[model samples]
Target: MTLAHQTLALQTLGLSKSFGGFRANSDISLCVARGARHALIGPNGAGKTTFINLLTGVVPATSGTVRLLDEDVTRVSQQGRVKRGMARTYQINQLFADLTPIETVGLAIAEREGAGARWWSRVGQNSAVVDEAEALLTRMKLGEVMMWRTATLPYGKQRLLEIALAMACKPKLLLLDEPAAGVPEDERHDVLDSVEALPQDVTVLLIEHDMELVFSFADRISVLVQGQLFAEGGVEEISTDPRVKAVYLGEDAHV
Candidate 1:
């Protein structure tokens, strides 16, 4: 049963979350195929964040299991998950305001290289780390501001830097939580394009409300409505789904 045994890069079975008698997620089961570009979309308060938090161990699921590469990780800590090739970017950038982009990305690179504890040594001694840090920043199109302070960069650039930082860990599964959020439309495409260009080995699971971006970037789409999966299909199937359209109402970006 090789086909039946095909391991997913990420999978959730009956994943559920609740708070004070309120159910934020309900028995959700889903999978992201290896190297797939998958998007999860839902209306506000549809438990998108709650679901993400469950995957990242930000919150314990009320009941369910999570698997990475077919290995059970439902109880893994967030850091543990990161150590196992899982990395994510948030809707809001969480950056070290005082560190330069180069320095910030360098730190992630150093950690990945197991040189973090020895970073006090001269930068020249860590040529490999420096090279990799630079490469990741450049790949994310942040090379021009690589030496700039994190706090001083524009919001869009900050988002890009966050992605660069995530990539520095060399994740097998990259979870992007609204990477284009708060970015001007003019700048969003560039950011999304960089994300889309990521290598095939880095399976992506995107959670975004921007349907245009979602459609452009996802090979398949899943619609979550009121804490449950309502529909899932290819871009065309999702775009024309009557249930999804009803959920979006007058929002032109729904499709």
Candidate 2:
């Protein structure tokens, strides 16, 4: 493989998606470098979610190719993508509300370690799994609430738990869809800190409307508008560009 291919965590060429007569994503190409902090930002109805779904194989593209670690995975199923080291969090966290953070994360780790069928039985019995889960929860700032039921934890903490679960997958590429959405102001910082503290070897593609998190977390930013890639550049350039500002202004979205 060429150096360029080796260095890219994700690459999409003419990636498009359509639902009947409506096009949710147009022909668009995007590249995220290995271990890069990349953010995808756009106004509501900009098809950001659709694009993310396409990347994760949650939804199939109308036409395009998705390359994860330079391997064409356009026909790969969602489960297949995860097995290939791609993991993601939803805008609305899908967590086991009844389970404690430790149990939840431990199960995820066990699953990754191929012990999922015996997850509950191995919880405390497996020292390696439990230890790894504890360390991941601590890193995500959930050590204090590790034993609490997920539903009882604060929204921000629940979000952190979701991230911790994803991290347990040991993903090479992590897709975070609006991690800060619905989080209260006071709790937002913790979420941001947790994101910023993620392991550098894990490439992050954050899809968020919160400009604060976007600017703070992304080294590179891509702007999507009406189902197409409108702009892409370093944080400074995209934040200061008049055209980008205009697009956000029209949608009453903060840049």
Candidate 3:
């Protein structure tokens, strides 16, 4: 895909993050093309999560600039960033236990559509919000079980629901922190399929360790090592990079 005309969904220039004296991410420069599926891959303790935290404003960066759709969002607060069309799902599930799938999605849609002020209004009576939630669930293929409590769903399904919630926000860019992490081997394909099915308009930046899923979904892949970007290229190029193979890919160097 030509990114020349598409605006950047996210970009970081000279980004650095530190915990006390140790740098978690240093001088990281990357750009995700608008609507592109970009992946960040590194082994554990490689600071992948820390970089994500800095981007999402969960942790402040020690230095650098973050641009989201041409707006400087480096120091933007999380909720403010959400309102600015950036949304993310945690590596671990963050859903409310008691809320049903429909209720959870309804809340997300309401938040995005600015209906929270009248949240006391009946759930069923809120036609616009309810309809939006229903449509989102239907698109996710979860409409039939929309009334089931989130806690009752299996781990993989819960992950899909989290993605559904992020979608409800109608984000211009979605940051997925290991959407396939922890799922059974048999169910990983389904989770990846659901992610692949999202609207092309929603650009995705994912941090994942699963090479197969990363290669299958990402249009471009960035390999990070020791808080620095080691390489950036398409799947084949990243897979064949000797530096990347020596560091992360390991024994399966030719993947």
lDDT accuracy of residue 132 in candidate 1: 85
The CA lDDT at 67 in model 1 is 90
Please give the TM-score that candidate 3 achieves against the real structure.
Answer: 0.93
Error of 3 at 152 (Å): 0.8
Candidate 2: list runs displaced more than 4 Å. 119-122, 251-255
Model 2: per-residue lDDT, tens digit, 78-164? 878988999999899899999999999898888788888873574579899999999988888999999998999999899888788
Residue 96 of model 2: what lDDT?
A: 96
Model 1 lDDT on a 0 to 1 scale: 0.88
Candidate 2 residue pairs that clash: none
Q: Whose TM-score is greatest here? A: 2
Which segments of candidate 1 are over 4 A away from where they belong? 1-5, 119-124, 250-255
Worst 10 residues of 2 by lDDT: 115-124
lDDT winner: 2
Residue 162 of model 2 has an lDDT of: 79
lDDT of 3 at 111: 77
**Clashing pairs in model 3, backbone N/Cα/C closer than 3 A:** none
